[model samples]
Target: MSTPLDATAIETIQGFDAEKRYKHLVKEVVANRKIWILIDEHGCVMLNTDDEDCVPVWPNKEFAEAWATGEWDNCKAESISLNKWHSRWTHGLEDDELAIVVFPIQDQEGLVIYPDELDYELKNQAKKQR
Candidate 1:
C-alpha cells in the first residue's frame, strides 16, 4: 500500500471475477505479510453461508473498510500478520471448522476455503516471491 488506494483501483479490483480476485489475494497477502478482517469490540466478525461459518478477509485496509457497513457498521478493519495467522488462526479455525472467504465483495462470495487450505496456498505464494 505504498501508493494510496484510489476509487478507480477499488472499482477495478472489486470488478475482478472470483478466480482473478483469489489470485490477487494470494499475491497481495504474501507481499504485504498481513490479512485484513473486520472486527468489533467482541472480536472478528463472521458471515454465514448456509450452515457454514465463514470469516471474510480482504487484501488491504481500504477493501476491508468498505464492507464495514450495514450490520457490520460498527466494525473496524483489523490486520493479522502472516505469522500470527499461521501460529494461531490456522489451528483455531480448523478446530472450529470455520472457513475463510477471501476478498469477497458485497454481491459475490469470494473463494471459500478452509484455514489450512489458505495457509498452504499463502505459503506457496510466499515461497515463489522469495
Candidate 2:
C-alpha cells in the first residue's frame, strides 16, 4: 500500500496540472478525495493522504523542520485528531512545544480531511522522548 508520504511524492512529480487530471490522481487517495490540498510558501503542493496517521504534510522533513524554525511560510499542518489547523508562522508563535493541528477526521455526518489540513507526521519515536 502506498504510504501517506508517497502521495506527496506523486504531487511533486505531477506539479499542478489541470483540475480533471489532478482530481483523478487525488481520488486514488481515499483521504484526498474531499480534501483541500496543501501548498508551501512557494506555492508548491505539499502533502496528500486520507489516513489520520499521515498529517502535517510538508515538502519533506526538512521543510517541516524549517517551518517549525520559522524559515518558511505558505503551508500548515492539520490534525485529524485535534480539530484545529494553523499556518507554520502561527504554529511557531506558540511555546517550545511542537504545535500541531489535530481534529476529527470524521465528524458526526461523515469523514473528510480538508486539503488545507494535510500533513505528514514524522515517525521518530526517539525524538518524542526529548
RMSD of each: 1.2, 14.2
Question: In candidate 1, how many clashes are counted?
Answer: 0
Model 1 stretches astray by more than 4 angstroms: none
Candidate 2, 9-85: lDDT as tens digits: 64453344333323333343233212232345664332223442223332223223334433434465432112232
Root-mean-square deviation of Cα positions for candidate 1 versus the true structure, in angstroms: 1.2
Worst 10 residues of 1 by lDDT: 1-10
- lDDT (Cα, 0-100) at 68 in candidate 2: 41
Write down the lDDT that model 1 would get. Answer: 0.89
Which clashing pairs does model 1 show?
none
lDDT of 1 by residue, 1-130 (tens): 4344799999999999998998998888889899899999999899888768999988889989989999889999999999999999999999999999888888888888889889999999999988
TM-score of each: 0.94, 0.23
Model 2 is weakest, by summed lDDT over 10 consecutive residues, at 102-111
